[model samples]
Target: MKQKLIVEGHNDILVISHLLMAKNLRITGYNTKERYEKEFVSIGTGKSNNDGGKENALKAFKAALKTEELDRIGLVVDADSETANPAIDTWRSIRNILQQNGYQNLPAEPNPSGTIIAETDKALIGVWIMPNNDSEGYLEHFFEGLINPNDEFLEEARRITEGFVSDERNRFSPTHQQKAKIRTWLAWQDDPESPMGLALRDYPRLGYMSLDTPLVESFYDWLQLCFDTYVE
Candidate 1:
């Protein structure tokens, strides 16, 4: 049987899609068909008014259930830029949407099949990958103690992100740049005591680790957990 996976994410998928392309990974309708015979579906919805973060995530999640054949889901969300802790409201909205649609009892913890990737105060998933400085190039003041301004990882990340975005200027905005940063971060957040927790507590405005890093290994772990918990 083919393995199935569902990722409820935001625009960060755009970068991930690009990263997969760089690795020669063929993503067919969200799933990396050539490698795992598995299906990867992303739900991009959220608040429609403000960049549609919430609306896009809901749309993706809803669409996945209806359009794809998946056994487990990984829901990724931001902590509202570490402003006021919007996780509860964001989660409630998501749950209401799901329950209203027909899900029975949603699990509390991030079940393997259904997980919630959240950061403290970062822009959704900015701190997870590269520091906020790399994206905004101006948030350097906020990154003190959290990350070294001249870290080598930032340069590596920049090289990897070349050609991912068309307009270089967009990489500085709180919305677009932050989203891309988070995508890169998610690709690399599994190391022991990953900076995710510390970043959150220290720099709330910069946001915490949502998934902007290249957390492929972490994602794999999450995928397996979801598969085990929900599939079989």
Candidate 2:
């Protein structure tokens, strides 16, 4: 059976595809915005580069419904980058789409453990807002949380990141401070230019601990359940 997972950006497709592999979830196919398969569950970005973000995730969701052999689907978007609060606004819009499609038992709030909607006669659907469903943040914030406490350079990298501001020298949006910090940590790594995907693959060396953190565990569990990947 084939499943689909949709997210918000190019790196998400890369990061998550690799993250699943780290968890021993087999991604039979390779990367892209159309599909990534954990136990053959495909991963894709929500929108085109010109319009990527939580706001456009719905477009990807609608398209995933058209997969040739779709069985189930999972969607992950940042809560609300502008405010980083609970993703009620994001979830509300998604709920409308789900309801319109006859997917029932929609919840008013995203589950802190991640949201899964499986009913007797409808398609299985799951939704997760990053940095946990309860907080306000984007993918970078989520990546930052994946860092291991044991990593020696995390604090130093954070200190370096704090040294800069949103001035000309630092052009990243204020909401993306985590991105700079994570990337700074990555830049100091052996390869010096590892993307989010490789950062996860590098693990201990990159200060990223994939499976041990509660955040990672919960997310992995959500994927397993969403795609019907079970252990014997």
lDDT (Cα atoms) of all candidates against the true structure: 0.39, 0.71
After aligning candidate 1 to the native by TM-score, how far in Å is the CA of 190 from where it should be?
24
lDDT tens string, model 1, 128-155?
Answer: 2112211212122122223343545544
Q: What overall lDDT, based on C-alpha atoms, would model 1 receive against the true structure?
A: 0.39
Best by lDDT: 2
For model 1, the stretches where C-alpha displacement exceeds 4 angstroms are 1-11, 14-39, 42-54, 66-69, 107-218, 228-232
Candidate 2 lDDT tens digits, 2-120: 66677766677777767766766753342332444343333343434553666566676876664434667788888764544458877887888887777777888888889999876
lDDT of 2: 0.71
Error of 1 at 151 (Å): 1.6
Report lDDT (Cα) of residue 180, candidate 1.
50
CA shift of 161, model 2, Å: 2.7
